[model samples]
Target chain A: MSFSPLIQQLITSLRCLPGVGPKSAQRMAFHLLERDPDGALALAEALQKSVSEIGHCKLCRTLSETEICDICSATDRDSSVLCILESPIDVLAVEQTGGFNGLYFVLSGHLSPIDGIGPEDLGIDKLLERVQSSDIKELILATNPTVEGEATAHYIAAQVKDLGVKVSRIAHGVPVGGELEFVDGGTLAHALAGRRSLL
Target chain B: MSFSPLIQQLITSLRCLPGVGPKSAQRMAFHLLERDPDGALALAEALQKSVSEIGHCKLCRTLSETEICDICSATDRDSSVLCILESPIDVLAVEQTGGFNGLYFVLSGHLSPIDGIGPEDLGIDKLLERVQSSDIKELILATNPTVEGEATAHYIAAQVKDLGVKVSRIAHGVPVGGELEFVDGGTLAHALAGRRSLL
Candidate 1:
C-alpha cells in the first residue's frame, strides 16, 4: 500500500530539493513529522518568511530583503575592485575568508548551452553597464572551475577588453593542505601551468 | 558580513535536520530561495499541514491523521500477526515491499540508554497492553540490527514471552546485492551464524 494522501504529497513536494529523490524525500518527511514537529514548524515559518520577503538585489543580483543587498551597499569595501561570482553562496564563501574587501556582482548561474542559459539570462548587459559607469580598475573572475564558468569568464573578459581595466581569474591550484598526489590531473595541470615566481 | 535575518534564520532552522550542518543548511536555504521558491512554499505548506493534522495511531502508535492508522484499520490485513518496528519510516519501507500482510506497532525510536531512553520512554506498556487485549499470535521484531535495536527487541520479547505468542527477529544476512568481500566483519559474522538450511 502507498502512503496517506498528506504523507504522499509531502514526500512529492520534498523531491524539489537539489539532491533529494523519492526515498530521501520519504525519509525527510517522516523525520520531520515524527522526530521534530517543532523543528518542522520552524522550518515552515522560515521558508514562508524568506520566500515572501527576499528578492534579488538590484545592483549585485544577490538575495536581499530590499532592492540593495548588504554587500552591495557597504561603504567600507573597495569600489575600484569588482569581483564577479556565479552565486550568493559563493559570496558567502568569499566573505568567510575575510580576504577580499572588493564589491561583488552575482551572476546567479553560469552559462549552459545545453540548458539554454546565456548572457541575457545572467543579466550580462546590466553587469556591463555597471562596469562602464563605475570607477572600477580591476575585475576579478571568481566563478567555479567548471567548463561553463570558464566560458562565462571568457565572454565577460572579451566584453571588457576595450574598457582598459585589469581583468584576472582566481588562481587554480591544489587546495591548501591538500597533497599533490590526490589532486585531480586537470587541477594539477592548471596549477603547474599557472605557477607564479616567488620573489 | 552575514546573510539577511530571514536567510540566516532559514539556514539555522534547516540545521535541525538529522545530518544537516552549517554548510548544508546554507546550501538548502540558498536552493529554496534561488532555484524553486514555489516548491519551497509548497514544502512549507506541507510541513504545516502534516504537523498540524498528523498524530499517533491510538492502537499501534504509528503516525496517522485519524485515531487509527491506515494499516491498522485496513480490513484485509492479518490482525493475528503484529510487526514491531523502530520508526514510522520502517513502516513505510515494509509497506512499499507489499510482502507483509500484518499490522504494525511503531516504537518511534530504539532504546538508547546513554541518551536516557528506556522501555517506558518507547511506550512499551502501551504495546504490552495492546498485545494482551488483541488476538496477536505472532510478533515480528523488525527493529534495526544495532545494539540499541537489539536491546529494544529483547525487552519486547521478554514482555510477551508468557503471552503465548511466537516472537522472532527479522533476520541477519548479507544484503541482496552486496558482495561478500565488501561486507563488514560484524555483518559477515551474523550472516555466517544465521545461515539457514536450503529446503
Candidate 2:
C-alpha cells in the first residue's frame, strides 16, 4: 500500500532540503520520476560534482572551487579594504549591489554561546592573521544586525583593535524602500542614534 | 561577482524541482554544500538510482523498480474491481485512506487536446485490453473533478461501455469537513443534488 522501496527512499532523501516537508518531498520525488527524468539526472550529477569539488577559499573562507576565490584573485579589486561577513551568501548579496570593490572575509557563522559556537569556530584567528599579513587599511563589519551577529562583529573588532587597521561597522538604519511607520523600534532607535550632521 | 561555476550549476539544477525559484534554489544549494554534504551526496545517489532503475509497472503503469507493482502483484487485492486514476500520486492517496483493496491503473496524465494529449497517449488501448482480458466486474474512475479529468473519465467510460463491465465515476461533492458557506457554487450544487435520503 506504500511506495516501492526506491521511491520511498527518494522521497525521504528529498526532505533534507531546508524548507521541504513530507508532502513536498513526496511531490518532488514523484515529479522527478514522472515528468522530468532528464532534469533529475542532471541535478544528481550537479549535486555530486558540487559537493565533492567545492571547498572554502583559503583567502576569504567563502565557497570556491579554487584555493582563492575570483574576487580575491582579481587584480582590479581593492585588497586594502576588507569586508567581513557571516556567511557565503552575504558575499553574493554584496557583490550583486555593483558597489564595494573591496576584498571579503566570510566568518561562516555568528557567535552563539548557547549553541557552543565560539571565536575559534568562526575562524577569527585566521581573519586576524590575514589582516596582519596583508596591507588592509580598513575593515568593515557587515554581519547581520541580529544580537549574535552584533556580538560577533564586536568581538572581531576588539581582536583587531591593536592591529593598526581602521575598523568600522556597516551603517544600521531604515531600509531604502521601508516606510517609517512600519520600521521596528530598535531600527528607528539605531537610526536616530547613528544620525549624521548634514553640511 | 557571481558564485563559482559548480555552485552556480548546482543552484540552477536545484531549480528543476517543482515550485523552487532562483532564491530557493540558491538556498538549497548552499544549505546542502554548507550544512549537509552527507545529505547532498545521499540525495544525488538516490536520484541517480531511482531515475535509472525505476520503470512503470507492466500491469498498472505505476512507477516501480520491479516489472509489476506491489498492489497489482498481491494475491489478496481484488482483481474483480479496478480503480482508474490520473497519476501515481492518486494511488498513494487512495492507499493512505485504507478504504479499498482494489487494483489501480495509472493514466499518467488526463486527456488534454489543447496540450496535444489524447486517448492513445494515455494508453487507453492497453487499458481496454486489460479490461477485456481480465475477470473485472466493475471499474471506478477516480480521476479529479476538473474539466480535463471529467472528459477523460467520460471518454474511457464510453470506450468500455460494450465490454460487459459495470463502469462508475467517483462522486463530485463538497469535502467532508468543508464549511457550507465557504464551499464553491458548483461543489455546493453537486452536494445538494447528490444528497442521500435516510428514510
Candidate 3:
C-alpha cells in the first residue's frame, strides 16, 4: 500500500483502463518494474505516439495516421457499396472476414440518448452527405446487436431511406458455427423474425 | 494485423508484462485508446517515473525509494529474525499475512543451474555477510516450493549453519484452502517429511 510516489503514480494511472482496478493496477506496475524496463519505456513512447499521431480519417472517421485511412483511399474497394459501423475495431472485424469489398463509414460511437449522445454527435450528417454525393448503391448498417446498437441502426435507416439509397441491416442471430442452445433469447427472437428461405 | 503504427507500437510494448501475449496486449492497447486517453497518459508518466525514481533497497535488495526500505527502518520489526525470500513479491506476500514482524533479505532470484543462475548470481554471499554481522538468532528460508527454491534454500542453509545461526526452512504442502485430491505428489511428499506432532 505504501509504494513509492512513482510506483503509486503508475498504479493510479493503470487503473484508468476499463476493468483494471486498484489491485490489478498495482500488480501491473510491479510487473513492469520487475520484468521489462525497456517495455515500460516502449509503452510510454507508444502512448505518446498514438495520441499525437493517430487521428480520425476525413471521410469515414476511422483511426488513421494520414488524413484518409487505407480503407478509404483504396481504389480497389467498392466505393458504391458503403458499410456503416460503430467503431474502428468493427472495421478490423469486417476486414478480417475479407468478405465485403465495400468502403466503411465509422460512426466512432452509437446514439445513447440517456447519456446525451444523439445523431448529430455521431457524424450522421457526414454519412448523409457521402450517401448523396457518391454513386453509392447500397448502405449496409452493421452496428452491434445491442439495444442501443439496434436503435442507432433503425434511426440511421429511417433517415437514409427517403434519399433513394437502398438501406439494409446486417442479420442478427447466433454466431457462425455457434450452437442454438447457447444463443440468447433476444438474438434467437431476432433470428426467427428476420428468417429467410434457405433455398 | 493492420493496426496503425502508434496502436501497433503500444500493443507490442504491452506484451512485455508477465502472462501478456500478443492478443491480450492488443486488447489492453485498444481499451486504453477507446476509453481513457488521460489514463493512458498517466500510465506512461508513471512508467517513466517508476523506472527513474525507484531503486533496490541497499540492505535487502528489495524494491524501495530510499537507501533503506520502510521494513528495514521500522523499529517494531525484529532484525534478529531475518526471512530470506526469492523476490520482492514474496516480501509483499509475507507482509500481507501480518504474521511475521521480521525484516527481509531478497535474493531477487533463485539458484537455477540449468539457467546459469547460481549462489553468487542470487546474492548468497551478501546473505552470509548479513547473517555473520548481525545478532541473528533465526534465519527462515521462505523461498517458493519449486526445485530451484529448495536448492537455493539448502545452499543458503549450509552456509548459515556454520555461523551458529538457527537455519529453518518453511514447510511445504497443499495450501490451506486447496483440495487434498488436487494437491501434487511432490508437495504431499514434502509435507509428509516435515510433519509436526499434533498436540
Candidate 4:
C-alpha cells in the first residue's frame, strides 16, 4: 500500500541509515508511533541539535560539541602515546574496548587514490604537523586492514620517518575469539604473517 | 580507547529505530559520516518536518499534513464507503492493492484488554458519531485477523447493527499467492473457517 506523503517522506529519510530498506523503514516508522512517540520526538530534536551544534574537534578532527574533543581535554589520557584512526566511529569502537588509555587522532577519512582521495583529502598533512610539533613518543597507526587503509598508513609512516617519532602499525589478524575454521583465508594469512614469538 | 560522549549519544539515539541493534546502529552512524552526509542531513530535516507538521486528519484520524487527507478530499473516491482500519499504516496497505476507492477511518490501535486498550481508547465513539451523521452506506471493518483485531471488529459491527447500515468485515485467510506448504496451519484453518462457496 502507498503511504501518505508525510509518512513516505519519513520512511525515505529513515532508509538513509545502513541496512534500512523500504520495508524496514516503514516498520521503524510504525514502531516509533506505536512504542515510543517520545523517542521519535527526541530523535527529531537530537538530529536538529547535533546537526547544528556539533563540529569537528580543532585538534583531533573528531566530532565534538566544543572546540576540542573530550579526549583532547582529558589530562589523564597519555598524550605522548597517540592512536591514529580513520574516522570518528573508529574512535568509538576503540573506546568501547576500554583497553587503550592513549589519546586519539581522527583522520575523518582514509586515502583512496581510485576515488580521488589523497593525503590532503584525508588530513595526513595535519597528522604530520602534529607529529612534528608535539612531544609524542609513539604514533600507532590503527587504520583498517584494507588495501587502501594499508597504503594510507604506509604513506603516513613514510612521511614521519625522519620526524624522530617511533611510528608503528597495529597488528592485523583474525579476531581474538574467532575460530581458525571460520576465519577467512586472507585474515588467516594476515594472522600467520603477523605471528609473535612465544615468551 | 573510549568514545567521546557526543559519539556515544549519537549511536545510542540511533538505536530507537526498529531492528537496529548496537552493531547495526554503529554501522549506520559510520555510514552516515563516511558515505552519505547529505542523505543524513536530509533525514534530519525530514524527521523534524514530519514530527512538527503532520497530524491526524480531522475526519478519518489518518496521518496527514492538512485538515483532510488526500483520499478524503479526492473527488473520485466514494465517500459513502468507508474502510475502518487499525492504523494509518493499514490505510497504506489497502491503497497499495489499487482496488479500494473508499475513505478510511484509522482506529490508531486495536482493542486489547490485556494492555488496557478498549474501544473508547481507539476512538470507537468518534467512529459511531461519524457513521451516524454521514451519508455512509457501508462500513468495512478491515482490522487485522488476530484475536483482538477480530474482537474489535465484531464489537464495532454489533454497535452499528441497529443503525440500518450494511456492515461487513474483511475476509481473513491465506494470502492470495501463498503456497500450501509455506502457509502455516493456523492460516489454513482460518481460510477454511471463513471459506465461501463459488456461485
Candidate with top TM-score is 2
Error of 2 at A192 (Å): 1.6
lDDT of 2 by residue, A1-199 (tens): 6789999999999999999999999999999999999999999999999999999999999999999889989999888999999999999999999889999999979999999999999999999999989899999999999999999999998999899999999999999999999999999999999999998
Candidate 3 residues B83-192, lDDT tens each?
99998878878988989998899996889888898888888898898888888899999998788898889989888777998888897777898887898898888778
lDDT of 2 by residue, B1-199 (tens): 6788899999999999998999999999989998899999999999999999999999999999999988998999889999999999999999999998999999979999999999999988899999999899999999999999999999999999999999999988889888989999999899899988999
DockQ-based class of model 1: medium
Clashing pairs in 4: A1-B96, A95-B1, A95-B2, A100-B1
How far does residue A85 in candidate 1 sit from its true spot (Å)? 1.1
DockQ for each of the predicted structures, in order?
0.71, 0.90, 0.64, 0.51
Best by DockQ: 2
The C-alpha local distance difference test score for the whole of candidate 4 amounts to 0.84
Kindly give the stretch of ten consecutive residues in candidate 4 chain B with the minimal lDDT sum: B1-10
Give the RMSD in angstroms, all C-alphas superposed, for model 2: 1.1
Q: Candidates ranked by TM-score, best first?
A: 2, 3, 1, 4
**Model 1: per-residue Cα lDDT over B147-178, one tens digit each:** 98998999999889999999999988899999
Local distance difference test values of all predictions, in order: 0.90, 0.94, 0.85, 0.84
Instruction: Write one digit per residue (lDDT tens) for candidate 1, span A1-199.
Output: 6778888888898787777778778888888988889999999999999999999999989999989988878898899998999999999899999999999899969988899888989988998999899899999999888999999999999999999899999999989999998999999999999988998
Ranking by DockQ: 2, 1, 3, 4
Best by lDDT: 2
Q: How many Å off is the CA of A16 in candidate 1?
A: 1.8
